[model samples]
Every structure is written in structure tokens, then in C-alpha cells.
Target chain A: MAGETVTLSSLVTWLSRFRDLVTENRNYLTELDSAIGDADHGANMARGMAAVMEKVGASPATTADELFKSVGMTLVTSVGGASGPLYGTFFLRFGMTAGAVSEFDGAALSAALRAGLGGVVARGKPELGDKTMFDAMSPALEAFDASVASGGSPAAAAAAAYDAAVVGRDATTPLVARKGRASYLGERSAGHLDPGATSTAFLFQALAESLAQG
Target chain B: MKKLINSPDHVLADALVGVELAHPELKVDHTNRIIYRGEPTKPGKVALISGGGSGHEPLHGGFVGFGMLDAACAGEVFTSPTPDQMQEATKVADSGAGVLHIVKNYTGDVMNFEMAAEMAEAETGVRVESVVTNDDVAVEDSTWTAGRRGVGVTVLLEKIVGAAAEEGRDLAAVASLARTVNAQGRSMGMALTSCTVPSAGKPTFELPDDMMEMGVGIHGEPGRHRVPLAPAADIAQQLVEPILHDLDFSGAPTIVMLNGMGGTPLIELYLMYGEVAKILQKSGIQVARSLVGNYITSLDMAGCSVTVLRADDELLRLWDAPVNTAGLRWGV
Candidate 1:
């Protein structure tokens, strides 16, 4: 989903699917957060997504870009915590980069996703291996780009991105945090995969799953 | 789970209802989950807004009034408020002068505030400036990380900066003062027991009867370390030493707040404050002003936090200025 479709409908569907995955894993995410964060990442994201679905349910966006922008605004206001803005910025920039395109070639989608990743980096100021969502997202985007360059379809590229996200998420367990609340734990922050990165992996997985449905 | 409540889901909303009913001076925007002063933003005056999770009561909400915040957005217990809520608060609180956002240094709080500022700027053309409070000395400040947690200094910063805004200061002045207040303050907290959020239906963390967690933040997240329970004097040293070590508090007249982390009795807090004061006196630190009680709190965590703000003459003046609000009311 990250590098697959630049259209507004595809983006909306992607966000809707992301919302579902977050809601389902809310408790699991919260459990991980209890180890390193305030124990609200799961609940916060669940509630934020619930709001997103509710807000977008009745009047679905006619365009993929509109849908992404709408979801971005909802997350910014509904998510409340750091995830809201970081994730919201991701989609806001994605929507802006993709503009009003109704559909996109693989290259267009790849560029939009890269642009979104750039937004997350700019806002979170996280570098590689900081045990942030960036850890998962950066690798996933790279995989998507590589897959598309190798002539994979949107669905196959999404699956590749999802695989990269999972690996990145798992990799966070051994890394020390240099950002967010977990960073406060210092060396003690090791031994726990970041709840943010884990949940972000779900975002890519959901995208792949949803695109398969389409 | 045995706590009194209609349902776990209704805790925050029901409590907010209770707040609006009990405090007529405060207005509740249940739709956006914001609690604010009922009065309109004063014309030509900069507006101040602060918010975080709900369990820390009288905070963003209690601090909203004449000499403090014009709006306080409330999120679920111990969760940061959403950006949209902040954006709405900014719009309503803005009086054509500008809006000052006082945010805690939590990742969620910082990001949400940033998004809200961006939204307000794009949609309403409201000039918004924010001061991030990171005065807690428990976490080491380094090149890599969000730095220290923002704790008790938040309460003091709001009051002092709120005064600056009340004086018809511009947004930049208000924001600058807020930042100065944050830089000059340091806080350290400890918890005897982990508090339970109503939704969670259990304590946030476990604590043995013989031990206490030191360097606790307002959230019930575990502290720097857990140590055996000590006497009031020893506990006072344990809390104050980190603060003293983190920053220089000597030679300046300081305002000290010995705050209870909810569920602690005033009797205990006053006793703790006595020990803290004696220790400060021995360390040659002058206490120009002090407040003892639950100013900022973790939900039902039986513990206390210490905050020392190195106040200048101007800050002292603002500290004593008239403030009419539900939480802090002074010279009318």
C-alpha cells in the first residue's frame, strides 16, 4: 500500500484498513507499552482509529487524496499522543504529494510514500535504530521501492514492504531507544521491541492485506 | 475493578460531566473533550492553553482561569489530548493577539501540540507559539533523546507565564517567559503505589509493601529505581538530591512546591515538605516561596514530587499577582 496506489480511494481504503488492524491489536500494543511507555499507545491508536472510521463512515471521500487528507486530520486531532502527529503527518504529506490523482502508476505511489516517510523523519527527528516507528517504516518503504523496480505489482510490492516492516519491528527488541519515552530507560530500554514500531508494522501488513482484497 | 463507576468506558466522560456540574466557572466541550474557562478570551490579550491526560486533574482544567490558561483540553486518563482538541481550544481562546501552548515533554504531547499549531495556522491564521516543559531531572539530558520528563514545573510555569499573558503581553513574550520558567525549574517525583486508571481497572504497576519507586513521573510508569521505604527525612533527600544535582538552585531565591502524587494525605505532604525545607536550608538554598499539596498528580499514586523554580524578581511579582480561577485564586 505504501508504494502501490496514489489515488484518493486507495489511500482511504488503506487508512480504513490501518484503523482496523490497530483496533484489533490495541490490547497487544498496550501490553508492550506497559513495558516501556505510558501504556496508552494501543488504546490511544484504537480510539483514534475508531474516530477516523466514525468520521469517515457516513460520507466517504470521493478521491484517494481527499481520503488520506481527511484521515490525516482525524488522526492529528483524535490520536492525541505522539503517534497521532507522526502518523498524521505521514498521511498528510502523502495526500499532498499525491495531490488529486484518482489513480497512480507504481512509480507515482512509490514517490508519494517516500515523501510520507520524509515527513515522519522530519517530525519525529528519529534516526535509524532509534526504536521508533521509523525503524519499521524506513525499511518497509525501501523494500517497496525495490520490489516495484523489479517489476512487482502493487500487491506483491505491498507484501514485500509488509515483510520488511515485520523484520524491522522485531529488530527493535535488541536496540536501545534514543527517542520517545523508551529513551528514558537508557540501556534498560533494550529487551523490549518498541510498541510504536510494532504497531506500525501492523499498518503495512494491513495495507497488504487490504490491497489483496481489492 | 472494584472501584465505583458506571462503566470503564464512561469514566472520563462521566467525570467530565461531574466537573462541569460542580464548577460553573468551567465550560465543558464534551464533543471535543475540552474543559475550559467559561469566560470569553479577553480582547487584545494572548490566550494560554495546556492539556494532557485526564487523571491529573485540576491541571489543564483546574489551571484554566483569569491569570492562567484560557483553555485546557482533557484526554482519556493519562493520555495526551488530540491535536484537533488543541486546535479548537486555540481557536476559541485566541483573541486576535495570539495563542501560547504550554506542553509537557512527553512524545505524544509534543507531537499533538505541533500538529494543532500547524492546523490552527493553516485554517484560522492563528499565531500559535508553544513552550515544551522538560524539567524533570530523573532522566539524563543528552544529545540523543527527548531529555527530561516535564513534571511539577508545569504547574508553576503555567501560573507565571499565565500572568505574563494576563498583562497583555504578546505571544512571543508569553512563549519566551514560559520557556524561561521551564529552564529555571527542576522536578523529581516518587511513588509509593501505582495508580489505576478506571478504564484499565487495575494499578498501572506493582509495588511491594516494603519498597517505593523513586523518580516517578505523573504517569504511573515505573521510576528510575525502587528502594526500601525510608523515613520522611531520608525520602526528602532522595527526591531533592536529584533535582539539586541536575541544576543549580543555590544563590537564587526559589519557589518550591512539594506536591502529592494523588492519594497522599496533606498531613504526610506537609511533613515531607518540612523535611525537604530543612534539607534545602542545610544546602544553603533559599526558599522564597513554597506550596504544599497535590498540584500535579498521578492517579491515586501515594507519593510526592518536589519542584524548585529559580524565580527572578519579575517572576515573583507575577507569582503574587491577582489570579481568579477555580484551581488557584488569589488577590482580587
Candidate 2:
């Protein structure tokens, strides 16, 4: 399955599964946020994903770029917090990099993931030990790139990314937050898992599961 | 959980209904969730716009009227407004003299407003300038953090800079005045109780009856430390000492505001103000103008914040300018 590609339908499936994941874990995500930041990350992500589903349901996009762009815009308009702009930027930049492609081979999908990570960095400016989504996403993208470079299939690359994301997410629990509202806690922000990193890990998990099933 | 709101989902929309009924002088755009001055934009006045999460009442929204904010965009409770809403407000409020965006220092507000300003200028060619207020001295300035949180000083900055814009100052002048006000002002807040977000349906934090959170942000985020509850006089000292330490308020006429978080009562606010005023007097700080009440507030968080602005004759004159708005009205 080396150089295996993911179709537009697979991307849609991944998003649908992600929507469900967020909806199921809304309370958990918000609970994580309560410890350090404002307790609304779960609700915000759920609301944004609901809006994304509605928008895509009404006008389905044929190309990968168009679909992701619609998802990004919906989140930007509806989410209303730091997550909204950060996740919105990720998908928006991903769409721009994909540029109307109908499917993504392992290499092409890796590039798109890299572009999304770039967008998050540009918007949030989180450092490696900042305990933000960047902690998870930065490593996940690197793992994906390495897997693809070794001629892995899309599923194999996504699995590599997912494993790296979990490690990154767990690493955030002991570090002091260096960005966003959580930074207000200073030393107090430690001992809690970063909500953004947790959600980002879920994203890669959804990607891996979807590609594996395909 | 036990709020006057109908449901967690309808809080913002339903509140707008009340705002429309309460203030006939303002126009409510339900679709975009923006509140505008009822009066049309003047031909040459530089428009002032500010907005943030909805829970901070009478702020950005209630201040929308003559000699204040020309438009205010409302986001969800404790959430920053989107760029599209801000871009729309910017275009509608601009009257050929450009527009000034008064933003708070929160990461979300800063990023969204920055995006809106770029979009407004790129799409419509309307000149736009922005000033982000980072007046909360509670959050220490560090290389790793997002700087200070914008707090009570925002209320003072909006009023002063809004008056400057109303005087027909251009965008550059108004933006410059806004920055100066932010530079001269400092704020510190403390919370007695944490407020619950409707969606979360629980208090953001639990402060025991014997303890209080110091240096709290408007959203009820934990402050610098938690100390045992103290008398109003002691609380005033705790809040005032930080502002004074952060900046030298002596040798200048100052405007002081003792603002309550929403759940705090007026009587308690007045008592707090008396204590704060006494401290300022002893410190050789001349209180040229004073405001006390729930001007900017957290949603039902029982707390108070103090703001001190080192003012001059010009700012005092601007403070005395005629202004009429739902949240604040005097000299009208």
C-alpha cells in the first residue's frame, strides 16, 4: 500500500468522525480547560464542528481544497475563541496548499499537514515547551513526513502522526504554559494537560482511523 | 447555571433583545450581532470601534452612543468576536476619515481584530489603525507569555479616546491618543467568587468562603495568588498597591475608576471606592475625576477592579466632554 492515496470521500469521513469525537468529548475537553484556561474549549470545538457539518451538508464540495476551506470558514465564524482562529487557520492554509486537489497521495497529504501546522505556528506563535497545540502538531507533522519519506502508505503515515501526537499531548501536563490565557497561571498552569494539545491529538487519531479503514 | 438567561445557547441572542429594548439610541443588528449608534455616521469624524466576549457588560456594547464607540461587536460569553463581524463594523462606521480599532490585549481579541483590520483595508481601501490596551498590571510581563491582560483601564481609555474621536480627530490622532491613555493607565482586579459560563454550567474556579482570588481577570481566571478574605479597606490596599507599584501616579492629576464585577452590589462598590480614594489621597495622587460602578464587568462575578490613569488637563477636559450612552451618561 505504499503511495496509497486518500480520496475526497475519505477526508469527509475523517471530518465526520472528528465531529463525533469532539461532540462525545465536549465535557472532557471543557473540563481540561477549566483547570488552567477558560472552560470552553470543548463547547467551542463542538459548536464549530457542528457548523462545519451543516455547511458541508448543504453544499458539498468536490475538491479537497474547497471542502477544507468551507470547514475552515465555518469554524472561524462560529467558534469565537482562540481555538476558532487557530483551527480555522489550520484548515484554511491546508486548503490553500492543496489547491483544488481531488485526492492526496501520502506525499501530498504530508505537505498539506505541514502547511496546516505552519498556519497554527504563524497564528499562535507557540514555542515547543509552551504547552499549546503546537506541542502536539509540530511533532505529529514531523513523524508524518518521515513515514511518507520512507514510502509508507497514507494510513501508515497517519498512524505515525497519531502516535507522536499522543506523546506530545501527555508531555504538556508537566510544563508551564507560555501562551494564551493559561500563561496567566504561571507555575500554577502546570499539573494540567493542555486542552489544545488534547484536541489536536484527537484530530490525528481521527485521521489515522479513517485512513486505516479505507 | 441559575442565571436569568433562557438557555445556554440563546444567551447572546436573547440578551441583544433586552439591549435593543433598553437603549433606543442604539441599533442592533441581530444577524451580525453588532450594536451601532442610532445616529448616522458624521461626515468627517473618525469612528471608534471596540468589542470582545459578551459577558463583560456595558463595555464595548453599552458604551456605543454619541461621543463613545460608534459600533461594538458582541461575541459569545467570554469569547472574542470574529473578524467578519469586526470588518463589517469597520466598513459601516467609516465616514471617509478612516476608522480606529480599540482592542484589548487578549490573544484572541488581538488576532481577530488584526485580521479584520487587514481585511477591511485590503477589500475597501478604508484607512484603519488599531491600539491594543494591555493595562492589567496583574499579569507580569514576560518573554514566554502574551503580556498583560487588558482590564479596567479599557473602560477609561474608551471614554477618553472616544471623546477625542468625537472632536473630529483623524484616525492617526485618535489612535495615538488611545495608545497614550493605555500607557498612562494601570489596573488590578480581585474576585470574591468565580462566575459560571452557561455552556460549562459550573464555576470556573472554587474560592473557599475564607479565601479570595487576587489579580483575577474578568473571565474569573485565577489571579496571582489566593489570600484569606479581608476587609474592604485591606482589599483596597491589595488592589491599589500593585497599580501604584507598577506606575508612578504622583505629580499628575489622575482619573480613578473603582469598577465592580457584575455580581457585586453598588453599596459594596461605593465602600470599596472610599477605601481606594483614601489610599490615593495619602499617596499624593490628585483624583481629578472619579467613576464608581459596574462600567465593565465579568458575568456575575462578585469582585472589583481599580484603574488609575495619570491624566493631564487635556484628558480631564476630554473626560468632562458631553457624552450619552446606555452604560455612562453625563454632561448631556
Candidate 3:
């Protein structure tokens, strides 16, 4: 079971788990934002993910492409912030790369996630140490690719990605933000964990939880 | 938070209800959270559209009327409105003439407006031009960042560009004017207290009674640095010096706005303006015109922002032209 390919059911579970994580850590994310950015990241993410789940529940998708496209569009409409577009684009690109498949093997999962990372970069133009969600997502995707390259299972790759995501999220605390609203604070932006990076860590955590449940 | 509303979740909706009730000249699309002028967009005249987060009252919505925006999309407080809402507004406001999107320079706002423009263009082949206003000097100016926050100059731009659009200028002329207004203007804001977002249920940040935030953002984003509370004169100097440094205002006739950030009273704003006037005069900058009030605001954050727009005869004429809106009325 641990080495099984990811199914559409697991993808649904991943989204559901991510919603729970965002809802639980809503205040924590907003608190981090209040230090150096606007204090709406938590509420935005929770609301966006909830809307995604609701839409997915009402009209279920049979393939990975259909599922993520719906998720992306729902987030783009419901969440009205930088996160909405950035994260929405990520899922949209993931879906585009995932094609109309009933299941995803380790390599397919890695390729889909890499496409997602590319989407974030294209939309936000984030770089290393910019203290955005990209800071967590970039390393996490790299770890995902690394694990798959070593002939690991999808579950193992997810766990590796989550660990790397946590490390990347932690690394953002000491960075002076050079993007988004936090960049307005200049040097004062240091010593605060980026809200975007922290939420992204939850994303990897949700993926790990869903795949590890196998 | 102790706000006058039904609930935190219904704040934007509830506020839109009030906007609908109070102003019959403007039509509120409750489904899309957009406010449009009761009258349709003229057949040949270019239409103007602008919007952002909702907490800043009487901004995009209040400015929808005879000589201002044709439609305004409303988002949640301190959040950019979604692309669908904007695209709807764009389609509704577009006539045979094109529509111009006047966006503020926030990451969310720019991205959302950009998406709206693309969607509208693809669907209806409507010509759409977007002008992003980034006049706030409080932010760091680096290619790496999102640049400055759009603050007070937006109000001035709406008035000036709206009149030009009313005069039957094409989309290119109107958009060029909007860009000129943005490039020639500069703003700086300082907060005496933190504004509470209704959903957050608490102040965004804490500040001691004896301290204040300089270079503060409209959404209570902390500014360049916190400093001890100073007298109005010193604060005015802090505000004016930075703007003056960012742009040379002395070479041209200027239109100045001393705007409130919601909580500050009229007396205090006038007092602050007095100090600002003295500095401008001492600096040998000729101020051709001035407005003092809570035009663009942050909710319940007691502070003021100053905007200086360099103007020529054509711009001053546009500024003086007939206008009618919930927020600003002149020459009507």
C-alpha cells in the first residue's frame, strides 16, 4: 500500500487535509503576517480552500486534470488576494501537466508538482530567499523530484518533500522580504516567518499525510 | 471588533446594502459586488473602471457617477476583488468606446485587474487599458518588491482622468493622462494607531500610546520605522520631506491633498494641513490648489497621508471640470 500509485481519491483527500491544516493554523498564519505583512493570509487560505472543497464535492472529477482545474478556478474566484492568483495558478498548471489520468505514479507526481512550481514562479517571479511561498515550494518540489529519482515510492517522496518544506519554511524567518507587502518594511521584515511560506509548508504536510495514509 | 455591522462575515455585503440605500444614482450589483452609475456608459465616450479592497469607503464606489468611474468592483475589506467581478464590471461599463481599468499598485490588485482585462478581452473583444497607480513614497523602491502602495493620488487621478474621459477622449489619451497623474504624484502616510479588521477581531498590530508608525500602509502594514510621537509640525515635516525627496514638486504648480485615514477628526486634519502648508511655503513650492479631508481612508486608524500632484493648465482645467459623485462634487 505504501508503494501504491496516487489515485483520484487520494488527491481529494490531500485537498481535504490541506483545508483542515489551514483552518487549524489560521490564526498562526495571520499572526505571522501581522508582523511584517497584512494580517489576512490565514483567513484567505482557509476561505479559498473551503470553497475549493465545496465545489469539488458538488461536482466531482474522475481524473487528476479535472480535479485540479476545478480547484484552481474555485480558488481564483473565491480568494481575493495575491495568494488566490499564485496558488490558483499552481494547481492549474499541475492539472495541465497531470493530463487525464486516473492515477499518478511517483514520476508523474513529481512532474506535476514541478509544473506547479513553475506556475508560481511565472505568476509571482519569486526567487530564492524572497520570503514567499516559493521559498518553501521550491525546495519541497526539489526534494520531491530527488526522492522520485532515487526510485522511492510516491509516499516516500511526499514525506521527503514535507521535511524539506518545513526546513524551507523555517529558513524564511531570518529573511528580509523582497516581495509582496512585507517588502514594504525593509529590514524590519526580518525575524518574522513569512505567512505564504508557512501556509505552503502545510500544503506539503497535507500531501504527506494523504499519501502516507496508504 | 466593535464595528457597526451585522457580523464580520457580512461586513462587505452589509456595507454594500447601505451604499445601495444611500445612493440611488449608483446601481449596486449585489451578486458581483460592483457599483455602477445608474446611467449607462455613453456610446462614444470612453468608460473608466476602478476598484480594490472594501474597507476604504467612498473610494471606487463613491466615485462612480457622472464624471468619475463608470463601474467599481468591490472586494472584501483589505482584499482585492476577484477577476470575475472585475470582468463583469468591465463588460457592463464598456460601450463602443473602450474601458480603462484604474488599478492601484498592490500585488493582488494588479494581478486581479490584469486577469480581468484578459478575460474581458477574450470574451467580448472589448478594448481595455489598465493604469496602475503607485504613488506612495513610504514603501521601498526596488525592482525586487511590489513597489509603493497606491494611496492618496488615486483620488486625484480619478477626478482628473474621469473628466478627460467625459470629454470624449479615446482610450489611449485617457490612459496616458491616468499614467501622467500617477507619475507626477507622490504620497506618504503615518499611523497614530492600528486599524482593526473586522474578521481579525483584533488590532493588526500593537503600538504604545507614546509611539507612532511612520510610513504606514493603508491596511495597517507597519511602516519604515516606529518613532516616538512628535508634534504635528514635526510629523508634517516627516511626511512632506519624504515626498519632496521622492519627487521635485517645486518646479511645477501642485495640487495637494491632506487626507485622513478614517479615525482622525476634521480639526486635527486641518491642524496637520496648517503645518504642511507652512513647510511647502518655506520650501518655495507653489501650491495651486488644496483639499483637506478623509477622502481615501483606512478603517478607524487615526492618521493622515499627504499627496502632491504636479499639474499643468490642462490638468488643472480637468480638475476644475464639472463632476458629480458620492465622495467628490464640484462644477456641477
C-alpha lDDT of residue B235 in model 1: 96
Q: Write the per-residue lDDT of candidate 1 for residues B220-299, one digit (tens) a residue.
A: 87787889999989999998998898889888899999999989999999999999999999999999989999889887
TM-score of candidate 3 chain B vs. the reference? 0.99
For candidate 1 chain A, which ten residues in a row score worst on lDDT? A1-10
DockQ-wise, the better of 1 and 2 is 2
Per-residue alpha-carbon lDDT of candidate 3 for residues B1-332, written as tens digits (9 for 90 to 100): 78898888799998899999999888999999999999999899899999998888778898999888899998888889999999999999899799999999888888888888999999989999999999988886656578888999999999999999999999999999999999999999999999988878889989999999999978888889899999999999999999999888877899999999999999999999999999999999989989999888888899999999999889999999998999999888
Error of 3 at B141 (Å): 3.7
Which candidate wins on DockQ? 3
Q: What is the interface RMSD of each candidate, in Å?
A: 1.5, 0.9, 0.9
Cα lDDT tens digits for candidate 3, A1-214:
5755998899899999999999999888888878887788988999999999999999999998999999998888888889988999899999999999989999999999999999888888899999999999999989998999999899999999999999999999999889899999999999999999999999999999999986
In model 2 chain B, the worst 10-residue window by lDDT is B137-146
Fnat scores for every prediction: 0.62, 0.60, 0.63
- Count residue pairs with overlapping backbones in model 1: 8
DockQ score of each predicted structure, in the order shown: 0.59, 0.76, 0.77
Which candidate ranks first by lDDT, i.e. highest? 3
